[model samples]
Target: MPVRDILQLGHPLLRAVAEPVADPSAPAIANLVTDLTDTVAHWRDTTGYGRAIAAPQIGELQRVILLRLPGRPVWPLINPSIIAHSPEKLVVWDACLSFLSIFMQVERYEWIRVRYQDQQGQWHEAHAGREDDLAELLQHEIDHLDGILSLDRMVDVKSLCSREEFERQFKANSPYGR
Candidate 1:
């Protein structure tokens, strides 16, 4: 699998909702998962940042996302959907591969239940809560499938900050900090 180009912010395609994958077992989807895995891996290796990526970020208008948190195996979520979520919310700084240079403060559910198919086409429901990073990550990736960006969820204009400023001023307090 080769690393594909990541569509940057302001790309028209980034705003387009992705189509649901009709057959998770299809060869095309397999290739797409591989490409997403490779692409995200490359990004994490080069930039020291990146936890996951969605198909739309690569110009593939399909509801697919790849995630590989530290110490976890890389995997793809096919046609993922958030089935339930807590009313409680947590505000955190969020960034995207499409707009790597900007970070914004966005509110996300403290917990979420997701339904999705694995690469092998098996259906599964997973839950993540405030204690787990997946709560935010799953929300972020699923938003991509719906053509929503972190920019759309920003709390306010003042919440927006450049990556450099984020690192210098906020990284020290971030749970996601290095």
Candidate 2:
């Protein structure tokens, strides 16, 4: 259960598209998912925050993402892709493990249809949306798999704020908390 170091924003690795997991059944991929799960849980325990984390965030150039949405068990997505999306958009103040202390408002589709494979090589599809916090988290992590960061999705550049400032000024109405 190694909690790997989460790569930061300026890291070159964070800016490059991650490769697909060639074999979902590979031991290395399992290890990578384990590390991601450990890291996300640790971050939540220490900061009382964190929902999902992508493999790329830990410098693994593979399309794997670990999610822990409210009231659900671990959802490991390998080579996930958004097959379709709603025209509706939801704006939220987003945060990331890559830049833990920073927050910014970003626009994401209100709902999306996705297809992904599990760690065991099983394929599945699901629709996610803002109603359950799945849409935003999925979009955020999938963007990581494609080398896109929240900074690049900002709806308003002026929406950038430090965690302290965000809490003091915008936390109440911030779409991130839900």
Candidate 3:
């Protein structure tokens, strides 16, 4: 598995709607999934935090997303789509691997239900509620597969803050802040 270079903003690949994986059990598809997992692991190890990685982000036009949930197993979603979304909205700070140095508040559903195929080509459904950051992360990566970026869903661009600023403010607002 190779650690593919992540495509940055302005790369045409990021804008193209990814093609569905025709054969999840195919060798090439399996390799791509392995590469994606390796890429996510590499990023997490290097940066100390990372949730998901999409094929487009790595210049692959295949609809594949790898998610690593906190305390859960690493999973792959092939050709995922949101089958249902909650009426309520939630604002979350989002940062992209492709768009480094910019963090923004994107509005997403409080809960989402998605359908996807596993590496073995089996279809499955998952539901994520408002309190589930893992669900939010999955949605974020799936957006990439659909040719959507966080910038497009930002509720207030001005509310965006640098990484340092976000951390500082978050900590300052905590109960520990004197």
Quick one: best lDDT, which candidate?
1
Q: Provide the clashing-pair count of each candidate structure.
A: 0, 0, 0
CA lDDT of every candidate: 0.91, 0.88, 0.82
Q: After superposition, how far is residue 126 of candidate 3 from its true place, in Å?
A: 0.8
RMSD after Cα superposition, model 2: 1.3
Across 1-178, the per-residue lDDT of candidate 1 in tens digits comes to 8899999999999999999888999999999999999999999999877999999999999999999788889978998999999999999888998998999999999999999999778999999886547899899999999999999999998989999999899977774584
Tens-place lDDT per residue, model 2, 1-178, is 7898999989999999999888999999989888988999998889767789998888889999999766789889999999999999988889998898999999999999999998789999999986667888899999998899999999987899899998888877754555
**lDDT (tens digit, per residue) of candidate 3 on 75-160:** 88898999998888878777788876667888888889999999889999999785547557878898898899998989996978
Candidate 2: the clashing residue pairs are: none
Candidate 1 backbone collisions, by pair:
none
Report the C-alpha displacement of residue 34, candidate 1, in angstroms: 0.7
Residue-level error in angstroms, candidate 3, position 123: 0.8
List ranges where model 3 is wrong by over 4 Å: 171-178
Which TM-score value belongs to model 1?
Answer: 0.97
